[model samples]
Target chain A: MNFFACENLSAGYGRKEVLKNITLSFEKGRIASVIGPNGSGKSTLLKCMGRLLKPSAGCVYLDGRSISSMTDSAIARSVGILPQSPSAPGDIPVHCLVAYGRNPHKKALSSFTKEDRETVEWAMHATGLQDKRFLRLGQLSGGERQRAWIAMALAQRPQILLLDEPTTYLDIHHQFEVLELLEKLNTSCGLTVVMVMHDLNLASKFSGRLIAMKDGQVLLDGCAEEVLTEENIFDIFRVKSRIVDMDGSRAAMYMGVA
Target chain B: MREITDSDAKRRLMTGAAGLMLLAAGFVVSVITGTVDISVGDMARIFTGVQTDGMYHVLMNIRLPRIITGAFVGVNLALSGAILQAVLKNPLADPGIVGVTAGAGLFAMAVMILLPSFTHLVPPAAFIGAFVTSLVIYFLAYDGGAHPLRLILAGVALAAFLGAFMSSLTVLYSDRVQGTVNWMAGSLSGKSWIHVKMILPYTLLGLFGAGIGARYLNILMLGDDVARGLGLSVERVKFMLTMLAALLAASAVSVAGLLGFVGLIVPHITRLIIGSDNRFLIPFSAVFGGIIVIFADTAARVVFAPYELPVGVVMAFVGAPFFLYLLSRSSRS
Candidate 1:
C-alpha cells in the first residue's frame, strides 16, 4: 500500500486554482523535497498532502484509506504537518512546545500520561533541546526555536512528516542544521519527510528524491543527478544555470534570467 | 507547550492560592466597609447564624448578596474577555468594548419595558442579543482575520448605535426608566439573592466550559493553519468558545447591567502576572476579576460617603487609560 499519496488532486482558494490535478506518492522511510519558483503551487501541494486543504477534485489516500474518511486527529496520528513559521505563545517553554506535537495522540482535556511525557522528552532529546527545555520559546535563537517546533512535530511520533518552507528564515548554517536533523531522523527513526524547499542546493543534497514543479505540474521527479540537469533547470526556472560537481555532489549555479 | 514542569506547576498553585485569598479578602472588605459598618464580631455572629437584628438586615440580605453578585459578574466578564482574546487573537476584545453588553442591555431593556410580564426571560434574551452582536461584530471586523483595530472599531460603532436605541427607549418610556438607569450605569447596587441566582448557574457553566476549552485556546494561539494541521477542528472550537463568552457576558449584563473594564483589564492584568496558559489564566482571571470588581464596588460605595458612584463609572475612569497604554505598548511591539 502507498504510505501517503495524493491522486489527481485539484484544490484552490475561492476560484483561484493553485493546485490542479496533481498526483504524487511518497514511500515509507524516505525524504523527498518539492522545489519550484514562487506561486508554482509547491506549498499548495504540500497542504493537500497534509489534508490542510480539501481537494475540489480527486482525493488523498493515506495507507489505502481515503483522507476524507478519517477524522482530523486520526490523520494527524499518522501524519504531522508543520506549516511555514509555526508559532506558539512565546511565554511557553521549549518542552511545552514539543508536547503540543502530541495534540493528535491525546484527547483535548485528558491529563498528560507517562507515555506522553516520555515521548515529549524523547522528542526534545532527539532535537537536542534537552538543555533548553526549561527556556521559553522567546529566549531561544531562531535556529533553536525552529528545532523546538520540529521537536513538537516529532512528539506526535508521526510516521510521515510534512513541512512547508521549513528553512525559509534561517541562515545557511541553521538551514544545514535543520536539514541534517531531518536526514538523521529519516535514517535513524525511519521517518518519512516531504517538504517544500526553496534552496535548490540544500534540497538536492539532503533529499533522496526531488520533485520540480512549474505551473502546478511536476516538471521533473528523480534522484539529484537525474533531475538537477542544466537543461531541466533552464526550462523549469527559465534561468541560465551551470551544474557544478563538487566532491561528487551536484549544485545548480544560476547565472541570470534565461 | 506540553505538560507541567514542577516549578511551573508550583508557581501556578501559589498564584491560584493568592488569587483565592485576595477574593476572600475582597468579600470581607465589601461586607464591612459599607455605609453601615459591620464589625468583625458582627460578621462572626452573622456567619454563625446568630442573627443580630441590628446588623443582620444590612449584612445578610443587602450586603452579602450584592457581594456575591459582584463576584460572579467579575468572573463571568473576565473569562469572557479571556476567551475572546485568545479565540479572536485580539487583545482589545471585551464584552463592553465590543458592544456585547450593549446588545444584552438593549435586549434586557426591551424585555423589562415592552414585555414586562416576560421579565423572567431577560437572561436568555440578553444571551441571544449578546450572541448575535458578537457574531455581527466578528463578521464586520473579520476581513480575512479579526484585526485588533478593526474589531475595536466595529465594536465602538455598534455600541454607539445600540446606545442610541437605549437612549430613545429611555425617552419614549420616561416613567419606567428608574430600574434601567442603574443598568446603564452598570453597578451592583440594591442587588439581592435574586440577582445572585440570575448569574450563578452561568458562572458554574463558565468554569466548566473554561476548564475544557483552555487547551484548545492555547493551540489556537499557534495560529489557525497550524492549529488545523494538528487535526484540530479550529472553526468549531472557536465558535464554541465565542458562544461561551457571549453567554457569560449576557449573564452579567442581565444581572449587573453594562460593567466594563472588568472584562478587558482583569484578564490582561492576570496574564501579565502569570503567563497565558489559559488553564491557569482562566481561573486566575476569574479570581482576580472578582477581586477587582469587589474592590471597585467597595470604592464606589465609600468614595463619596453616602452618595455612591456606579462601578462602571469607576471602571471607565481606570480602564480607558490602561487600554490606551496597552494600545501604545502593543503598537510599539
Candidate 2:
C-alpha cells in the first residue's frame, strides 16, 4: 500500500494559489524527491502533504486514512515532518530539542517514559549527534544544527518523514551528508522519505523517484533517467543542461540558459 | 547524551528547589519585618494559638493577607508574561509592556467611576477590556501573521492610548483621585482577606491552565510552520494560550492595580536559571516572582519607616534598569 498520497490538492496563502490541482502518491519504503525551479510551488506542495497548509480543494491520506479526519496526535504518530529552516530557542540543548519530538506520544503532565528516552537516544545516535547532545543549538555548526532538527523528527518514530529543502543552507559536503543520512534511514528502517530538493544532481543521485514541478503543477514523475533528461530540464527550468554518467549514477550538469 | 540530560535535569531541579526556598524566606521576612517587628519566636507563638493579641491580629488580619496577595499577584503576572513570550515568540512580551495591564486598568477605572455600586463586577470587566485590547494588538500586528517586532510596536501604541485614556478618567473623577492614584501606582496597600479571596481562585485556575499548556508552548517556540507540521493545531493553541495569558494578566491587574516589571523580569531571570522549557520555566517563574514581589513589598513598607512607597515604585526602580541592561546585553550578543 502507498504510505502517503494527496489528491486534487490546491493550496495557497490568502488566494495566491501557490499549488493547484496536484495529485501525487509515495509508496512505502521508497525515497522520493520533489525538484523544481524557484517559485514552482515545490515547498507549498510539501507543506500541503505535511498538513502544514490546509488544501483549498482536496485531501491528504496517510497509511490509507484521510489526514483531515485523523486526530492531530494520530497523524503525528504516522508521519513526521521537518520544515525548511526550522528554528528553536537559542539556549535549548540538542537533547531537549530532540526530546520534544516525543510530544505526540506522551500524555500531558507525564514524565518521559523509558521508551521515550530510548527513542530520543536512538535519534541522536542515528544523526551522529550524541557528542553534542548537551551543547546549545547556537553553539553548533550549521550542518550539526540541521542534523539536530532531523534527529528531532526521527524521535517521533513516524513511518513516513517529510522534509522541505533539508539541505538548503549547508555546504556541499554537509548537503551530501544529510542526503546520505536520509538514504541510510530509508534503506535500513524502511522509512518512507519525501523531501524537496534544489540540487538536481544530488536529487537524481539519491532519490529513487523524482517529481519535477512547474507553475504549481507536476511536470514529470519518474526515475532519474526519465526526469533528469536535458530536454525536460530546459522545458521545466528554462535552462540548458547535460546529463552525465558518474559512478554508475546519473547527474544533471546545467550548462547555460535555454 | 543520557548523562548530559541527567545533569540538566538535576540542574533544573536544583533551581526549582532554590526558588521555593527563597520564596519561603521572602514570605517569612514579609511577615516578620513589618512596623511592629514581630520576632520569629513571636510568629511561632502566634501560630501555636498563644494569645499574643496584637501580634496575632496584625499577622492574621493585615500582614498575612497582604503578603499572600502580593505573592499571588506576582505568580499570575509572571506566568502570564512567560506564556505571552512563548506564544508570541517574542522575548519582550509582558503584560505591562504590551498594554494588557493598561487595558485592565482602563476597564477597572471605568467600573469604579461609572458603576461604583457594582464593585464586584470589576474583575470580569477588566478581563473583558484586557481580552479586547490583546485582540486589537494581535490583529494590528498581524499583516500575514504577528511578527515579534510588529507585535511589540502595536502593543506599545495601544498601551499609550489606553494609558492616556486611563489618566484622563482619573483626572475627570476628581473626587476619586486619591484612591485611583493609589490603585494606578500598583499598590498592595490596605489589602484585606477580601482582596485575597477575590484573586485566589483566578490565580490558581490560571496557573493550572498554564502548567497544562506548557507542552504546547514548547512546540510554539519552534515557529508556526514547524509547529503545524509537527501535527499541532497551531491556530487553536495560539488562541487558547493567548486567552489564558490575558486572563492571568487581567486577574493580576484587578487585584494589584498595575504591577509592572514583575511579569517582564521574573520570566527572564527564571529562564536564565532554568532555561526556556516552559514545563520548568513556568513554575520557577511563579515561585521566583512571588519571592521578588514579597521582598519588594517588604522594602516598600520598611525602607522609609514612617512613610511607605507603593510596591510598584520599588519594582520600577529595580526593573527599569534591569530591562535596559538586558536590552543592551542582548544587542551586544
Candidate 2 on A1-258: residue-level lDDT in tens?
A: 776899999999896998989999899999899999999999999988888778899989887779989877778887889988888888889988999888888776788999999999999999999989899899998899999998988998999999999998899989988989999999889999999999888998999899999999999999999999989999988898888988878997789983
lDDT of 1 at B12: 80
After superposition, the stretches of candidate 1 with alpha carbons farther than 4 Å from their true spots are: B1-10, B96-99, B111-124, B135-164, B167-179
Task: Choose the strongest candidate by DockQ.
Answer: 2
Model 1 agreement with the true structure over B34-147: per-residue lDDT tens digits: 778789888988889886797898998999999999999999999999998888777777876566877888888888778878867876777778778878886888764555
Alpha-carbon TM-score of each model against the true structure:
0.93, 0.93
lDDT for each residue of candidate 2 in B251-288, tens digit (9 for 90 to 100): 78887777899889999998888788898989888888
Deviation of model 1 at B244, angstroms:
0.9
Q: How far off is residue A56 in model 1, in Å?
A: 1.3
TM-score of chain A of 2: 0.98
Error of 2 at A11 (Å): 1.1
